[model samples]
Structure formats: structure tokens, C-alpha cells
Target: MAEAYPWQEALWQQLAGRTQHAHAYLLHGPQGIGKRALAERLMALLLCQRPKGLEACGECKSCLLLAAGSHPDNYVLEPEDTDKPIKVDQVRDLVSFIVQTAQLGGRKVVLIEPVEAMNINAANALLKSLEEPSGDTVLLLVSHQPSRLLPTIKSRCLQQACPLPGFEQSLAWLGKALPDSDEQERLELLTLAAGSPLAAVSLQAQGVREQRALVVDGVKKLLKQQSSPSQLAEAWSAVPLLLLFDWFCDWSNLVLRYQLTQDEEGLGLADMRKVVQYLAQKSSQGKVLEIQDWILVQRQKVLAKANLNRVLLLESLLVSWAMLTAQR
Candidate 1:
């Protein structure tokens, strides 16, 4: 394995050692969490002519070519465009690579990123290769959700489960890298990022905290009697509602904990959580889940249609909470 993230040590060992079977590997994980990094690492392990003490021998011919992105044997399958799915044509092209000769004349490492992005036809097309893979062909499929993959596809490869790191583990890793940083603030960022160290680091890089704060503060004021959807929409038009949804889910859990334990730290919700719950009780038998379910559905729509007017959609939908609270 190439030098990898700390969490990947055990996974890399299993794939590298000949003590186990050498079949296609499913390196499943969400965006970030170093899925791409791990895929590249596995590619090095398979294609490297020699390995130095469990790490890739970078000086070898295969490693050199692979490093420079000119390796002919290793194929990476991806969607035609960022928003597009892997089409039948692309998957067909992939099958051609698998059966044909390797440019490196050795192991062929094929990596399909977010394999779930493959359309139905493309997924079915890949099935034949998965079922009868040629010798020395290594498959690496990375995904955030395995369930999104076809059952046939899932059955054809070995699954390497990659989960988000724990908050403390992520925090400690960020600490060394983010030395001289504010501890409390960083931990808060780490916690908000779902314990993915990369996420925390990237969030810091992009000033996600300030963005989130702007999102929360913008929505908070809309949770009141006689709140106008138009007014709320106008205020939050520039904010991304999907990002708001992400924060709300986290905030809702905090509220749920507050409701149960009355913990003050959790009690200080950024205001949208209360709005969502307020709407939920009004429409869902005092259950916040109904509101949450609607939000989830809207999220899918938002992802599917990038042109959605987030402010209008969210303001109209979330205004229910204000009405519910006013009724109370």
C-alpha cells in the first residue's frame, strides 16, 4: 500500500498480503474520508513491481508510470461529466479494457469511483466482468452507500467497509495537523463534520462555520408568529438550503437530546431545529420526524434539480413551523 491515512492501515494490509484471496475489492466510503487516496494506494500495491515493507516501492517502473498518470494497464472509470451518471457506453469501454492486454504486462487495477453513479444499463453491463473477471485484474469500487449498488454488482466483489472516524479520533488527528489552532472551535468543527477529519480540515479551509452560522441565523428569525414566507425567502435566498438541511439534522439531534436530558449545551439550538420540531408537532402528532421526512424528500429533489429555488422552497415548507408555534 502507498502511504495512506491512519485508518487505512488494517484495510491495506488485508489487500496487500497474499495470505488472503486476490479478487476484486470494493473500497466503499463517502466523499472524502480518503476514498480516492485509498483507491490510489491499492492501485500502487497491485501494480508496483516491488513493495518496501508494506508500502509501495515508488522507484519501480509501474509506480513511476502510475504516479505520472500515464499507466496504461490501470483504468479509472468515472461519469462523463460531474453531474452525469456512468453511461452504458462508458461501462462498455471499461469491459473492453478488462478483456484486452495490459499495457504494463502485469496486474491491471481498475477503479470505479462512486460506483453507485453508474446507471442501470451501465451497472448491468459491468456484471459480466464482475462475474468472470480475468486473471490479475483488480477491481476497486468506492461508494458512500453500498445499498445504492445493484445486488449483482454487490455480490461480485469483496466489500471493504469504511466508516467515519470517531469524533475523538478525528479531533486528535486534526490536533497535530492543526496545532496552534483553537481547540474548542476545532472540536466543534470536527463534531459538525460527522467525525471525518478531512471534512473538518476542509470545512476550516472553506470557512464552513461562518457559512453555517449565516445559514442558521438567517433561518432562525423566520420561526415566529406571522412570519412571512416571502420575507424569509428573501432573507435566505443566497444561502444553500441543502447545507441548511445538513445542519438542521445535526441540530435536531441536539434538540432531541435536550428534550430528553435538558442539557443546556444542546439546548442552545441555532433556531431552525426548534422551527422544524414546532412544525413536526403541529403536523406529525407531536413527532418531529414528519417534518424531517419532508426535508429529506426535498433534499433529494434539490440534488436532482440543481436549479431549484431553495429560498422559495424552504421558506414555504419551513414556514409551517412558525404557524405551528403560533398555534401553540
Candidate 2:
């Protein structure tokens, strides 16, 4: 059985209560908010031989097959490699599967996660299946960044926005998900995860807090002239490039926010609050904005899986960041 999150209870009721299901649904939201799980739950409900009031009957044959990963009526499309674009050939294969009759004589369901992973050609290939529905087939498209999707693709489906759970709700859930961690640690994790509870758990598992501590220490050293850009970049190589960029990007934003609004509360996580405030006071807004722009552009390239020289990239970023306080 799919884990039904408390935050998604109302969403589940609304979706499962529909008298007639849409041929396709576009579930769009921020990452780590359980959008994929919600889609899977819906898929199970649609395929279940006997549904028990907005939920799937776990004892049914269909449920058993799905749980066993042998369901013929369901298909999942995703990139072969993580962070890579879905190839056109994969979409072609999915098109072939969509045309086939369900072996169980029930509804055929297709789930494509992070749909924005499809390149233009692959997305175009998928459009054919979306334009012409076959039998009782239902397509569920999940996108963390729906803005990247084509307008035509967005137009063909019932677009549903999945919102983040409230802070109190997220903390309550996190208490159960991470029983060993205290409230302060969980609070830090949730803040690090940008208020996404699942992301908070994942960050905990990935030791993101440790990685963050290392980076924060490095940043403080860099500002104090105790470390070189090259040294810190190589030392932090094991940390994910995207994660590093995200932190720098966030820090830059916080610095600018504090400089403009002078809001001490806006200085982000406690790990770097002092640094953010110091940089904000030392650096000019123009210089901070410039660095922020550069970070955003490079961040996009990283997100696109560009062939970047990681060490060089990090060194350059640190060089610019170090200069932020040089003018003081």
C-alpha cells in the first residue's frame, strides 16, 4: 500500500472522489513534497480490482502484481540515468506500450516522473500519445519544475498543483520520520530542506548537515584569508556540485535580502547567519547582485547537466565571493 501522507488526505479525497477520471493529469509541485507518491497511489486505485473508498484494496490480485512489480497494465517512464534527459527512443517505447491492450483487461496506466527531463524531441514524441488517447489508458505526468514543460503539453492535461505542507504539519511528520533526532536537529534539517519534510529526511540520510558544516567552516576560513579557493574547492569535492551551488546561491540571496531590508531574521540558517550579515554589511549591493546573477546562470547549467569543470567552477565562485568583502 502506498503511504498516505496526512497532508495529502484532502488531495486524495478530491482526486479519488472524481466520478470520471481525466485521460491525463499533470501533477506539478516543488521537489520532495510527495507528488510522485500521490501519483502512485492514484495509479494503484485506478488499477485495483476492488477499491475501498478512495483507497486500493491491498489484498487484490492487481495490488499484489503491482506490489510485486509485475503489473502488465502499468508502465513507468524515466531517464535511464539520474539527471539525464529522457531519450526519444524511450518515449517511442512508451508509445508502443500505450497502444497495446492491457493484459488484465483493466485500465492501462503510465507514470512519467520529472516530465521536464524529456528533451524537445522526446517531449514531441510523447505529445502523440497525449493527443490521441487509447482505450481506458490514463497518463500521470509528474514535474518538479513544470515551467520547463511545453505549453502544449500543459494544455492537454488537468494540471494540479501540489502545495507544501504547513510548517507545523511538516514538523509533526518529521518527528515521526526521524524519531532519533531532537526537535532542534529536525528543525535544522527542515530549514535545510526548504520546508519539505521528505527532503529533510533525505538530507539527514545523506549527511547534508555534516557537509554543510564543512562548507560553512570553509567559507569562514575563506573570508578570514585562512584558506585558498583552490584548497577549499578540492577539499569539498565529495560534496555534490549542485548542492554546493544551491547553498552559495541561497547565501547570496540572503546577503542581498539583509542588505536591502536590514532584516536580521532574513539571515537564513544559524550555521551562516553571522557570515550572511557580515557580507551584507561589507559588500555593496551591486557586487552582491552581480555574484547572484552569475550563480544563477551557473546553477542553471549545473541543473541542465552541462559538462562543467567542477573545480574550476567552484574556484571561480569562491574568487567572486571572496572579493565581496575585499572592498571593505
Candidate 3:
């Protein structure tokens, strides 16, 4: 296996070379922070017939098969379709695969990415396998939102936490990765990604920066009474609802912070400092908190598969935000 990220080295060291390995490991971390990469590296090391220290020997047959994506004992379970939940049948299949003997007479490894995507029934189905191991079996479950997982599921495995890198470290790594990007652009991307270096790089590559700017600008206009909620929603039709809601949630927190402290220090969103300050001054502390609460509730609804009218939801949030400064 190739080396994990620079920040992940210490954690990797702790996980490697244990006398007795757990039947399952839950690797929990924020999205785009290399949790999956770390899990993959560990998986390769576990399946390698001849591992050197914590890494796989690339010359081995097991390594070659894994690299070629044809390893007989390796199983990966994920949602069949994008944005869909993993079904119970999928977990059943994984359970069956786990009971089988390894083709190479070695350990069998099962990888489940974003385990939160598994619905309740699916999670319940996998619980038995997790509780009782059949053979030399290992399960690596990667989750970005571990809170959504069943507590019983979490308790059945040893958990490993992966944290975001420090700001300077993230910026430095991002600088080397995208040499052509200027410091300001890199910082902007980092801010947009909530300080996750890999997420920043991904957002930049996906042109989220441009879309984010449009949303922020539209928000500024809405707050200034220059744009209506419906108009802004229509203008931002291309932007995903979840992304917009998340951005609003972030901004709402900042507005509340400014209202409480009256200081802008350490408040991210460098490019929108002026707008954030303007909204902070004009908006009341209570109103900001109310809107923040509303955002949280709506975000949970969106995640819980609640049926919602997109345009109406967006308009409601925007209108509430625009009225934060209204005189009682």
C-alpha cells in the first residue's frame, strides 16, 4: 500500500503492528479528509501475503490482484445508485461473502464506504456478521457522518477518528497540490471546504468556488432588499439545495457570533467579511439564533428523506433571513 497522507501518519502508526487485530474497524472522519484512503491502505496491508511493516508488498500476487481490482477475497459494499441508501439485500450478500473461506487461504476483507448510507434494515442485517466472525475476516467501515449510524453498530467495532489538518498545514499542502492557484484563491477554496484540504482541492476542481460566489452575491443582494426571495431562488436554480442550505447554515453561525461578540476575528468567509458584518449589525441576536435553528431543523429534514418543496423551502429561508433586521 502507498503511504497515507502526511497528517495521517501518526494515526496509521498507532493502528499498525498490533498483536491482536479487531474483527472490525470503524474509520470515522469528515468527508474528503482521507478516511477512505487510510482505510484502503489498511485493507491492502491486511490482505497482503507479505507486508513490509504497515504496507503491502507490491510484488506479491495478492497485491497484484488487489491493484487489478480482481481480488477474490476482497468485497466492497456501497449503495448501488448515487444518493440512494444501501439495501438489506446488499448487506445479506456481504454477510454471505463473509462466511465463505478466503480463496487464497488468507484473510477476507470487506469494505463499506460511507456506512451511514445503509438504512436501518441493512444495518441490522450486518450486525450479526459484525458480532460473530466466521473465519479470518476483517471489516472496514468508513463513515463521514457516524452520528447517523446505529449505536449498536458503532459499539461492535473499534473506532478510529481522523481529524482535519491545521489551517497552515492544509494551506501548505493545497499550495503544493495546486501550484498554479494563488494564495487568495487557495484560502477561498479552503474556506469553502470548511478547512478540509482534500475537500478544498475537490471543490476548486468542481468549480464550486464560482457557484459559491454567485450564491453569496445573491444573498448579499437579498439582504440589501435589492432582490426578492423568489428571484434569488430562481437565479440559483442550478445550485444544489443541500449545498446552499449548508452555506446558509455556516453564514448564520457567523452572524450569530458577530452579534454576540461584535468582533470579526477568526470568522471565516474572508471574501464576504463586509457582507457578514453588514448582516450582523442589521440583524438581531435573537433573530440570528432563530434562523440558525430553522436551518438546522431543515437540514435534518433534508437528510432524513422528508418530502419538501424545493423552491418554497428556499424562499422561506431566504425571506426569513431577509426579515431578520425587521423592527418589532
Candidate 4:
């Protein structure tokens, strides 16, 4: 069974309670939320031979097949590799699958996650399936970034928006998810995850707090001229490039915000509060804006999975960051 999130109770009721299901549903929301899980749960409910009050009966043959990953009528479409675009060929295969009769004489279900991963050709191919529904087939499309999807693709499906759980609700869930972690630690994790509880759990597993501490210390040393950009870059080799870019982008935003508003409360993350304030005081707004723009471009490239020299990228970022305080 897909893990049911407490935040999604109303959403589940709304979706599962529908008298007639849509041919296609586009579930759009921020990453790390339970959009995918909700779709999975819906798929199971649709496929179950005997549903028990808007829920799948785990004892049914259909449920057993699905749990065993041998369900013939259900298909999942995703990128072959992580962060890679779904190829047109894969969409072609899915189209072929769509035209076939269900082996179980039941509904056919298709789940495509991160639907924005489909490129132009692939997305076009998928449009055919969406335009023409076959039998009792249901298509569930999941997208973390719906803005990147083609307008036509968005128009054909019933769009469902999954919102982030409330801070208190997420924190409450996190307490049970991570009983070993204290309240303060969970609070910090939730903050760092931008209020996404699942993301907070993932960050905890990845030791993001430890990595953040190291990066924070490195930045302090860099500002003090105690550590060079190249040395710090090498030291941070173990850290993920995307994560590093995210932190730097966040810091740049915080610095600019502080410079404009002079809001002590806006200096994000306690570990970097002093550093951000100091930089905001010393650094010119123009320089901060310049770095922020550069970070956004680089962050895009990272998201696109461009072939980038990690060390060089980090060095360049640090060099630009260090120059923010040079005018002082």
C-alpha cells in the first residue's frame, strides 16, 4: 500500500470519491510532496477487483499482482535514467501498450512521473494518447514543475494541485517519521527543506545539516581570507552540486533581501545569520544581484544535467562570492 499522508486526507477523499474518473489527471505540485504516492494509491484503487470504501482491497488478485509488480494492465512511464529526459521511443512504446486490451479484463492505468521530463518529441507523442482515450484507461501525470510543461499538454488533462503541508502538520509528521531526531533538529530540517516533510527526511538521511555546516564554515573562512576558493571547492567535493547551488542561491537572495529591508528576521538559517548580515552590510546591492543572476543561470544548467566541471564551477562561484565583500 502507498503510504498515506495525513495532509492528503481531503485530497484523497476528493479524488477517490469521484463518481466518474477523468481520462487523464495531471497532478502538479512542488517536489518532495506526496503527489506521486497519491497517484499510486489512486491507480491501485482503480485496479483493485474489490475496493473497500475508496480504498483498494489488499487481498484481491489484482492487488497482489500490483504489489508483486506483475500487473499487466498497469504501466509506469519514467526516464530510463535519473534526471534524463524521457525519449520519444519510450512514448511510442507506451502508445503501443495503450492500444492493447487489458489482460485482466479490467481498467488499464498508466503513471508517468515528473511529466516535464518529456522533451518536445516525446511530449508530442504522448499527446496522441491523451487526446484519444482507449477503453477504461486512466492516465496519471505527475509534474514537479508544471510551468515547464507544454501548454497543450496541460490543457488535455484534469489538473490537480498538491500543496505543501502546513508547518505544524509537517513537523508533527516528522516527529513520528524521525523519532530519534529532537524537535529542534527536526525544525531545522523542515526549514532547510522549505517546509516539505519528505524532503526533510531525505535531507536528514543525506546529512544535509552536516554538509551545510561545513559549507558555512568554509564561507566564513573564505570571507576572512583564511581559505582559498580552490581549497574550499576541493574540500566540498563530496557535496552535491545542485545542493551547493541551491544554498548559494538562497544566501544570495537573503543577502539582497537584508540589504533592501534590513530585516534581521529575514537572514535565513541561524548558522549563516551573522555571515549574511555582515555581507549585507559590506557588499553592494549591484554585486549581490549580479551574483544572484549568475547563480540562477548555473542552477538551471545543473538542473538540465549539463556536462559541467564541478570543481571549476564551485571555484568560479566562490570567486564571484568572495568579490562581493571586496568593495568594502
lDDT of 3: 0.88
Give the clash count for each candidate. Answer: 0, 0, 1, 0
lDDT of 3 by residue, 1-328 (tens): 5547899888888887776789999999888788888888988988999998777888799999999999999999988987788999999999999999999999999999889999899999999999986899999999989999999999999998897888999999998989999999999888878888998988888789889889988988897789999999899988877788889898888877887788879466776788778778887888888899999999988876678898999999999988987983
lDDT tens string, model 4, 58-110?
98999999999999999999999988999999999999999899999999999
In candidate 4, position 216 carries an lDDT of: 93
Winner on lDDT (3 vs 4): 4
Runs in model 2 lying further than 4 Å from the true structure: none
Candidate 4 residue 251 C-alpha distance from true site, Å: 0.8
Q: Give me the runs in candidate 3 sitting further than 4 Å from their true place.
A: 1-3
Q: What is the C-alpha RMSD of each candidate to the true structure, in Å?
A: 3.2, 1.0, 1.4, 1.2
Q: What does candidate 1's lDDT look like per residue over 95-196, in tens digits?
A: 998998777678888999889889788999999898787867888888866777888898889887875666677778888878867888777677666677
Measured by TM-score, the strongest candidate is: 2
Ranking by TM-score: 2, 4, 3, 1
Overall lDDT per candidate, in order of appearance: 0.72, 0.93, 0.88, 0.94
Off by over 4 Å in 4: none
Candidate 3 clashing pairs? 1-56
Residue 77 of model 4, lDDT score: 96
Instruction: Write candidate 2's Cα lDDT for 160-197 as tens digits.
Output: 99879999999999999999999999999999888999
Error of 3 at 242 (Å): 2.1
